[model samples]
Target: MPNALPWLDAAPVLAACAAVAGFLRPRRGTAEVFLVGAGPGDPDLLTVAAVKALGRADVVLYDALVGPGILDLAPKSALRVFVGKRSGAHAMAQEAISALIAARAAAGKVVVRLKGGDPMMFGRAGEEIDHLKARGIPVTVIPGITAALGCAASAGVSLTRRGVAATVHFVTAHRCDAGATPDWSRLADPEGTLCVYMGKEQASAVRGGLLAGGLDPATPVLAIENGTRPDERRVSGPLSALPDLTAALGGGPALIIIGWAVAGAEASSPVSAALAG
Candidate 1:
């Protein structure tokens, strides 16, 4: 007998067709990889693109400097992995972390290698990028606010002031190779501002080297800890006293600034009194 209802006549066949289409068009896995800068301990400083990337990340591989507040922005369902290197404590080696990112991306998982400050600014992002590229894993880099810039901004100090500093030099306190020593004589030039990353622990040594290189012992130096964070603290003092001031505040991740321009900023900074106290 002819079916009374045309729709019902083909219901079983229609359901089978829909099931076949669903199987053929299975949701494609998103294996996007992003090397995003989280900024220096301050989530507010993060770029719009960086924030969006974090929101989309399936798994976030973050560094210690990325801070906690920024991590909270990711979905609760996302996998948050800690592959960070602490200031004094050893953790997962950099190579292992890079390898992990590549492997995860290959597994069709969205990978976000979140770093503190600009990814290119001593974040070891170059190595990670190279590793991923070598393995044919798709990768993109997003820059973020660096610690030196953020610290200077928070302290109201210009890294380069007109007429005061025509040049600004950013150097890392930590040696690239275990035993390498930086040329302090060139770094101690009075014409430019010197911004030191990872130099808090070696405050005394850094001061001594600068002093020996003709940088005035009384030269103005500002040491900022947890720069740009809510607990941000800055201690301004003469180069010779930098170590003592840093120790007194209890050390955290820090950036050190030295120059005539920095010394000239004493009026706006309350850090001088904080250090004196």
Candidate 2:
């Protein structure tokens, strides 16, 4: 006849349930999609706007390069989907990823397409943007530090130094079409810094192209692996040694910096020291 559940005992259970409910509450936002840059590998490099967008994300579709620390910024209730692509293995095709984004947004969800590095730089964000725009979905973009800048800063290398590197160029070693190559002659500026992304596998090609294009073989080159992250490693040497230097780095997202500005930049480990010798 008396109350089966006492207030004190039931109070704790009810409070726990409330907390869970609050944590799992669905969020709605004005923008249907947010294209956020995760900023290399370091979570500290994430922009303020990027953080805010991630916080309010109802669904986050992230790439392989987006670290776990960055993804943890999203709400616990948000759906985190992996649509990342590595060299030979792709979790989801680009077309499928684009379609999923539109479908999620059309369902009235706040979708965040989280990319590593500045979304505009080699991130394929334009493709996603075009897809969303064609569907009339409102989207917002938040930029973050690109890998080149982050790696250069970590290595204490000034991409552009007075009387040295007058210009800077960012290029990718991998092309969408096989057997296609970038204009090496145009990129071989004596007074310019060249940063090559996704060049780990194509190190030999890069070295050969630059050499054939008449870039000074004695030019300094620095390869920073896992740049801006805790385990960051830097290897500095001549442009002729780019292939060996890159090979010593093992498997990791690396940025190859070529210019006089990176000549004397500090190397964290003996890999660079060995290469330099």
Candidate 3:
């Protein structure tokens, strides 16, 4: 009789063990999001952290400029969504993209927002971060190569040289608010290299600003389209010829580098010679 019900005596111990296990269990409803940089236009340039994040992503939100072959790193099961915006075409609005990211993350899925170039550099990461934080979603950012660095490397041009270019300034010709523009006068530093992002359509404004700011129109300038890609094109000339150079290329992502340091590239090379002035 004593043995028949003896197992019941351990109920308290078992209950305590259950309580400990419950305490150790992971909490539910937590959100996780990764803001990852896909580099300029080279899949090989992806950082290890970026690769890992993409591999484990349950959903990936990508930009228009993300390099080819980069998305292949993600698992086949991951949902790939294009959230990029071209000059005049937007696949998804900023607010809608943010809402979608937060919604996917809230469902307890691993979310990766894959962006072109560095997330913090003109990528509108702040707006997304703010949206996610307000909804209690945790965010992690992994940096990648910016367009200026990638374009310079592919063109064999140095953005900053020992004596020629002591500093480098990164500016964007496109603004979120239409009609608003960068202060080109402040950016026309003689000793610093100027890297213009999204300046293809605004090439004339860029040239005018630098010239008016007293930057020598003869300063060496290099325009790279589809930088670091197989179809990449390079045009090098004086600042006075920037607009024409930009116009010569097909509609593609482009970066404009202006400074004496650009002279480091072989302007006589076949790819750039015809446009080199």
Candidate 4:
């Protein structure tokens, strides 16, 4: 009976195995935060630094504008947090999200704040940096292609040219407060380009502002929705017709480009005929 090989059931062995696994598990948590740009919508546009940071992240808090494909870059074990903001629907308040991120980093977790387009471009990276730095948290930033540049390339247009558009400017049609209004007088240069971010919903205001500020009503305007994405579309018309063009784009993140640069692009480029009215 000594050599019967049935001396033990599997219970103790399984318990010991579980104990060993718990003992061998790697300790999790680090003390660093990376602010990474996910580019407009194309994963191919992500910078190498962005990729490396995502690969090492213990948690990624990303914006709504960031595409799903970019989220795939994070490790399987990494915690993905949706700290996204849409038209009026913000998953979490900015202050709360900042606190959460700072708290997590203070807990020594490797965190990544993934935003769409260049983080410095209306991404509210400055606020985040201030929040983390106040707590003495180390933060790193990785830039990616912005939507304006991506749209220009995809739409075969230039924001500035030698003589056509001597200067190019970027602005956000979304005011920080209800009483705030952009100084349209400074942006009414027909010879200059104005690229507006978060501009779709306020297209009427944009049109009226530019028109009231003496910009040429016939100045060409272009709206690119989901730029650099496979479903990217370009709608072009005169400044006076910008409202119609903006409405045509439906619901999607878009940029409004205004200037002779748009006119020049349409003149020489072969864009989709279906995009024209």
Candidate 5:
């Protein structure tokens, strides 16, 4: 979660098996499956471990968030399938997606499930893992740079800074179909940071809850849209101004960093000079 040694957290998260690697050694008798993270939107953000897996893929099941220039890593003959919402709208459901993976692996093919962010972080990887395990498929997981860390460094925003913020919480602002949304009052910490993922659709709810939870209306909020890529942009203002900020952002995927750590800070990446302008 800290800026330094960011990959330390990536070492052992939801991943327990050795990776299927590059052209050095040919894949063995048993074909393995890989669940890998593509990282925010930058191909460079991919880890060495993930790259090796991609090289060995027989068939890659990729999501909508995967950026351009990434699929080139796969072997030329490998089959690339787009299995995301944007591709089919609602035609391809999660169950069908899992079944597709199972069918391919059952045929003894090397499968790589390439998701946008870290597979474990709200990528629905757990369901896929469960499905694979039930069908006796071999699977490996590889972690990638989450959008929060990628955007923070690229945009010059620190989620956690010494003497400014010590604790950082990653919460989802997704509009849930069932159950209550996040408890904002319990999540607010003056000395801490809040990184909201998939938050643009519900920015108003986030703003209202934080204000009602005792966070100052003047508390700073910084949002990095299309983070880490060349077209990245930024917007920042007091918490009360989230609605306008959310409405103004392009249709690209975005994340929000909330707390004093980002207050009045100019973006380091080539982002908007000011929230208003």
Candidate 6:
């Protein structure tokens, strides 16, 4: 028989090269899941490393609060999954999300679990990390600007001001139980700055709790909605007027800042002395 053509051997070589590439390729991304922080609704806030990771990602699982602009950073081929979670509306259960992350990572794809604000804060990132670790999946966290700080900065207010705010407290306005209340005694302290997250619907209850705890009804309150976003809104009034102001303004992620620092920042800082009295 005539000698096989030289190209005949090329087929085997190409198959071997493909096999090696498959084997050398990561079972996941450079890391299993890159837990990236989407930052406070701005594409400029994205770190250089985060930008690179976004380009390499095969999938991006993002949250509701994460601005739509961050999606522009991801690779065109990447699969974008929206696990929208409002204060009460959760599309995917926590457990399901964890499993989904691990499953995607295990499939030899770069997985980016993009969350708004800092992942370690009120982000519930601990649960996801624990779940991934339990399955021997690698995970990494990238910090971003948290809402409290982000809102304060964008509003040109400081969360803690020397001689004005001696302490700062971050609390959730709405908890798992609607009727449950936080420690009003501590929250009532006038010396500290209070940052209430996810309290839009319970604005009245929040104001009432603070007032009942002996906080001045006229204490200055700054309500920032959709902080750091284009439609961001800010209202300065007394704690008593927060509910009405927020209701009138309508729509956005409402964050409440209450304390002497709000008014102390300036003699006439827009804050009302409780119900505009």
Residue-wise lDDT of candidate 4 within 203-240, one digit each (tens)? 88888888888998888888888888877777787788
RMSD of 3: 11.0
Candidate 1 stretches with Cα past 4 Å from truth are 1-27, 264-277
Q: Candidate 5: where is the Cα deviation over 4 Å?
A: 1-29, 86-91, 267-277
Instruction: For candidate 3, write residues 133-171 as lDDT tens digits.
Output: 998888989899999999998888788889889999999
Q: Which digits, one per residue and each the tens of the lDDT, describe model 6 over residues 1-277? A: 8767855667788998887555334454344688887777767777765676677789999998887678988888999998968866898988899999999887777898998887887788999999989988888787787888888888778878798788999898766566786765558988899998887787888888788889988888887777788887777777778787666555667778888787743212233333355
Q: List the residue pairs that clash in candidate 5.
A: none
TM-score of each: 0.84, 0.88, 0.87, 0.85, 0.85, 0.83
Clashing pairs in 4: 30-108
Whose lDDT is higher: candidate 3's or candidate 6's? 3
How many clashing pairs per prediction, in order?
0, 0, 0, 1, 0, 5
lDDT of 2 by residue, 1-277 (tens): 8877555467778998887555334455443788999998999899877887788788999998886599889999999999988898899989999999999999888899999999999988999999999989977788889999988887777999999988999999888888887876678887899999999898888888888889999889999989998888888888888889988886779999998888788877687777777
- Local lDDT at 260 for model 6: 78
Give the lDDT of residue 62 in candidate 6. 94
Candidate no. 2 TM-score: 0.88
Query: Mind giving the per-residue lDDT tens digits that candidate 5 earns over 1-277?
Result: 6578755766564354333323224556565788999999889999988888898889999988787778999999999998875312643688998999989888878899999879888788999999999988878899888888888888777788899899999988763355458988788788899999888877888898888888988778888888888888888777778777777788888889889999876643332344434
Candidate 1 accuracy as TM-score: 0.84
Error of 5 at 261 (Å): 0.8
Candidate 3: residue 118 Cα off by (Å): 0.6
Candidate 2 displacement at residue 146 in angstroms: 0.5
What stretches of model 2 exceed 4 Å from their correct place?
A: 1-31
Which scores higher on lDDT, 2 or 6? Answer: 2
Per-residue lDDT value at 105 in model 2:
93
